[model samples]
Target: MKFLSAAALAAGLCLGLGATQAQAAQKALLIGAGEYPYLPPKAQLSGPANDVRAMTQFLEGYWGFSKSDIRILVDGDASKQKILNAIQSWLPGATQPGDRVIIYYSGHGSQIPDTSGDEEDGKDETFVPTDFGRNGDQASDMLSDDEIGRALNMLKGREVILIADSCHSGTINRDIVPGLAKDGIDARPRYLPFSGSSTFFADARDVEPLAREVDTHLNLSAALPHQLAWETNGSGIFTQTLIQGLSSGQADQNGNGRITTAELLNFMRPKTEAWCQGVEQCRELQFTPNVSPRNEAFVLQPVRPAEPVQTVTGDSSEDVSDVLPERERDKIAVRILPGAMHEIGDEVQFQLTSELDGYLTLLDLTAEGKLVLLFPTDEDRAAGKTGKIRANSTLTVPDPSYGFSFVAEAPAGNGKLLAIVTQDRVDLEDLLAANGTFEPIDDKMGFIKEISGRLNTVWTGDTTNRSVSWAAGYKEYEIRP
Candidate 1:
């Protein structure tokens, strides 16, 4: 029972940046516009709602951002005034020097004539509010690049992360353009064009972004100017993928307990591109994110590495008996081939030898801090192999006939392999991330809690008299790029 605490800690890689933010914590302004009163129904988007909702839940739930600090302006609330107020007022007022500031916008992005001459293309990229161009007021309605630059300037010299899932600039872009929705896929571009009303007017302003070192500022543009940002299944592709990478610890490349700015960019680009080619492919449009300050980097999320843990051990000659304490009854033998540190795509194997005869459960704590059941996978069960392991017998994971091999993947970080010998079979179906291999659980704490509770239930009654006994051993390793 005491050993499971270490397993829980291995899974619950909590972030210090999230927990202890008292005054200089994270603050965000989320803006999403799904409906535009001035635009036609075809211009109406179905993604912003999902975008803002997912972000809010992740920020508050996983990142430990205070709900009050995260100002959400969705749908009707995402008017020009509200977004400006949140950006220029609420966010600036709530932020401190070391605080992390996030400005995420999801909706229609289009180009208005460059009233500001700084744009090289002679067009200013702008995001439309829900009531954009209403009352023939495009100047006050649209969120232009110049306007965005000005707003971001107020947050200068701070840790700022700006993600605009709405495309900036042209209706016809070379990078990733919006066209007719793909056959049978409800993919839509989050870009709206100036419809009907021809007289487009705007106040001239300077085009200047946050002038800061790369470490303090990270800018992510979903699609370059004249390009189209895509969304499908009622969510923005960029936004959904970004949230997944950040939440699942996929961006914590090197598994170093921290996610760096470079890691984030590297993680997002390949993952998003892969997702675009998946089932219900995203328009087949080439996906690209424009990131600036190519060299310098900073930690995006600060997660803790598990402290060294002690496992109960006994000699192989010891017999399983009620007189001996559970910890002293059995020594778990576990080994991994091809060394500890591995690069992506390297195939790995595990060898487990237990001193007692019992059901064996092998678990892997991924470099991304996800718990996976490596033993008793569906293939192992289907092959008619039970979970039991006899004393002095060796068990090889993925016995070749099971038809699967363990291959290393990205988000390189510290990884742990655990072997537990139990008196009774522990049911883990509820905590299972998926069938065959597992998916990373989003709520790690809840997952840990369930595991601990289940272990308690399985190992019930007094310690001395209890026939149930379990011993666990784990090996920690690292994965590099």
Candidate 2:
């Protein structure tokens, strides 16, 4: 009798452990659609598949999600029915209380008239499915935000994370024309009617409403609300940044050796913006990543032992400019005008003066991490605007004659301006190819990488031997609301 009782006790303990393990299981569903069969060839994208693959690898490598537990649907396999079924039926049915669930979607996002009247904006946001029809049957083909909300509502007991790397419209900058050379290469997201068939507008709007339904949601918008999201080299700037943040340990902002959902979003936001705007090869588009989280912060990755910190000290009295050879430093001087607090809508300007004839280029790094080319306007070049500034002459940038100006806007914070003065004409054709042509800067990484390399080369030593003797100066300022 005693032996039988002990055996029963052991069986109960084993069953309890099995149940705990089942409850702790983590599951993920990744969906990406780059090839839209029903849409035009221009609508086809190359980033979605790669985005899914990258996220899957991150989940398996860092998040401890098993390969078998993570389901993937990409390109041809990602249909509306399949997506809906996975979200509404499979995920909720498979996951229980205390379990973690992740759903990631990378593809084109669109908007249609709101039939359910649930959207405050009078338009329903949607993810473009593989079989989305151009003319009709949008109701059945596209996955609406409302449908996603409903599906998420079913998984209220579990910890859920939602990520979307797409935009609903290109209305963010309606006044600004899209594409290079008027070819409309920068197409807006597809728009469909709420019902049968009608015209649609590709405008941008906030994704926070849909995010409210989930425990946590992160949106990697290609552009700000109403702006167009861009693709380059068949991958998304947002996705690439996301992968880097998670994989590189840069997202561990608190140095806690773990990345939380909030930390991940915060890390990716600036990087995505910088990459989209800074790279010369990337289409110059506005991208801002958004996040919505509940009261509690969820850990995206397990905690590991913190790495050792290394600290280095430098002389406080020494000037950074002292590092440069005296000859280079004396050749150029730059300053910002109205050296006072500037509010939004104020015109900010840079003043550059040189001691010798040289080419000049100015670049702005905004508080949001966007890089803007500020000098060598196309109009200036066409009108024989030479970089050659007579010794002791000061040139006020955006000379009003050029009919261009830079105004401060939201994301008010400290920003910087860099002036690069070179003795010889710098070949900036690749960097400025689309300048003044209304083509969005496409290669942001390329621009940042090349400019950084140039800056390092010019600043490291005396350039007396080089054909291009260069000097650079920067000004930091605040943009107030």
Candidate 3:
């Protein structure tokens, strides 16, 4: 009797050990919007709504998450408070350390003035519900990014992932024509019917602190404020690109059949750029980490990938100029296009500083005056490390505190570099201008776009160089040295 009991107990213990091995960390929050009575007809197809639904399916089916493990909120009905409640409820309790949490949003996203200092622009990111006030009169309706970030911080887990499909300030744009209002009978056609009980007018102001800003054509449906601009992006851009990266095997760069954060960024960057070339557009697509996990063992092994082969070129003597901050116009230091030009792969450096914590952004203009290079803030360099950012033929020093310089690497002929230090960071701007002036590399701005595309078009986490994607406006080039 003792022998039989011992054998039975041993078998049960073996099964328990096997069950523990199969467990993994996985949770998701999905949101979308489609139904809107006003403005651009609410995307009758509701791209964002469909997009989030598909994402939910992929996570539950292929990512090993159970249906019940995912939480979904959709449409204008997916209000700020409701979304917050869902997020709070999804927090894991007493789970093992490696578990991961994912949050996804697909809908109109806008920015509201954040009087609080938590955000850089003092603007908080919010989701535009069908009922969101296109005119900024209703105070209680809008949500802020800081508010959402606070909720995310409240969760006990350190591995929280944030996937925002919302527009940030001037990044996304839908233009409204001025004369659309006075064009006779059909000229003032209201896109959506609004109860004229309130004079709804959109706050007509340029988005703050962005390198490029666009005016949008937004309304409750399409008619309020007689064609004013709003700070929101349609949902389709985030949805389509995210799906392409995850589903088409493009994101699985290592042939491992699983996705990583790096792969996702790599795959989505170019795909999004392609989607919004000219028509309603999103300028800067940002990927931020909500929580950084520490010392957690991942089921998927981390792999160190090979670096790019440095294309060598002979060093030429670079001209050094004092880059002085002209206090005449808003204390901004603007780049003056040099008269002479040289070949590609030339290096130039800038010595810069900053009094306040503001971004040091660089823009590489295309021949058509379209923006090609966008290396903003910390995204330009890994944290704590500072160096050069190659924008086609130009190099920029994009740091806040100390003076620094950059050497040009990725080759292109010539392009102009525009640097903007906020009105607040006047001291740093003055320091940089007094220290350096940029060197000229090429003649025309045509290839500048191509060169900028090549340098900035890096997929963050992929081991494979061939599979790495391009920047927001992916351009194909054929520049001969």
Candidate 4:
């Protein structure tokens, strides 16, 4: 669902600008008010405070922003006027024209009437500050999209990125009514319970077009219109994944040692989806996080350990996501054990785990680059064979009931085993009936492309054929003569 827009193109252009404007000062204003003072007790959140704290650490240690360059507002300090001042007055005054700016919000989000008439849906998205409704009317406290856009216009020509971790962000359409207050409705993956209400006001500031250098734009949001951003262990999953990509270098898809904005989206979308489906609190209702267009891409080649790899080809520690550009999820995991060497005729073992209930697809690669279907064989179809893999359960491959074992064969060299987790079963009767492995892949990198693009039909949830969610993962092995 990632499409391109003018803002995305401008953001991409900002990445190219980095090579020349190396001196641009990096600045950030992180806002998250977990304790909405005026709202009832059930409205409080535990994630936003943790989100701002986590981002402060990342911006300072990983992205190299000085502690002084970063500003934070959490709980009692994050009033509506203070947040506006921080962005509109404080940020513009402190930063130069070309400074690299980052603005993040992680908290409860609601909607108000679109008094400006720009919205076809009659609702404008808004982020709740700690002091919502404190200044006479709630609309004055709510931060609308246009208001934020107008604030970004003051940046003149700064390269800006906004990470909005909230609900109703994709295209806010839900209306709030007075009702029973709920706990973590936004954080629990449920639709707004009609208790979080706010009315529209006509005082919204008009917004000008974004500066040519990308003053205000975001390529994606933490969740979509109906989907809510959930938190675990006091941290928003969206921000946690963002930090993981930045610190772990796992989002570097092309393996050129550079993690582009496009690459990061490709990495985050599936992982967030998988996490939502995996967690018991969020599984009932959730959808893929909405993605916007960035025709131009910015590079995030953060310095990490010396583990570099191209798409699909990697070390023993690397998995399928290292090579595949799309379809990486956190719900399911596949690991190759001991990462040791073996001789011909030796059986290979694997450990596959899923945090939620799902189907399993196992594929194999010989040292010769030939591909084979290791599961759902013409052999085992019942007894949960090729059936639902229990959540929180581990499946050890090469079991006697599976009929066939993974006995290593000739062409003694290094090989790989891939384990894919899908929400539904993929019927591979064509390959299973072949009674053997497919011909050696003409191109090693093209192997995954072939599986996802051509050979495999059920691994994705696109409109064409696949209607289920899936994740890509693998493990490496070796065979000696």
Best by lDDT: 1
lDDT for position 422 in model 1:
68
RMSD of 4: 18.0
| Cα lDDT tens digits for candidate 2, 1-481 | 0000001111211122111122255788999888878765656777789889888878777666677778899988898888888887888778764456778888877666667877666776778888887545556578877777777767654556577777655353322232222232332332222334364444445545446433333333344555445555666667778778888899888875556657877887787666545433234445666655332144444211122212112211113233333344546667766663567677666678888666777665543334556666566678677656666788887677767665556656555555667765555655664554432235544564444333322111221111135565545566677
Clashes of each: 6, 24, 17, 7
How far residue 82's Cα lies from its native spot in candidate 1, in Å, is: 1.0
Off by over 4 Å in 4: 1-20, 135-137, 169-219, 279-281, 284-287, 301-481
Task: Write the residue-wise lDDT of candidate 4 on 1-481 in tens digits.
Answer: 0000011111211222112233356678999878877766666677888899998888777766777788998888788778888988878888865456788888777666667887755666677777875654456568777787677767754556677677653322243322222344334331122223454232322221111112353434676554567666577888888889877789888676567777888888889878766654455445455444342345553211123212223234243333332334355666654344767666555678886567676766554434555654545554446646777798876565655555556656665556666555544344444532333334433333323422222122332222134555555566677
- Model 2, 418: alpha-carbon shift in Å? 55
Which order, best to worst by lDDT?
1, 2, 4, 3
lDDT (tens digit, per residue) of candidate 3 on 228-331: 12111333444555566665668666665445545555566565444333223122322221111211112121111112212211111111011111111122
lDDT of 3 at 344: 39
- Which candidate has the top score in TM-score? 1
Q: Global lDDT of each model? A: 0.60, 0.57, 0.37, 0.57
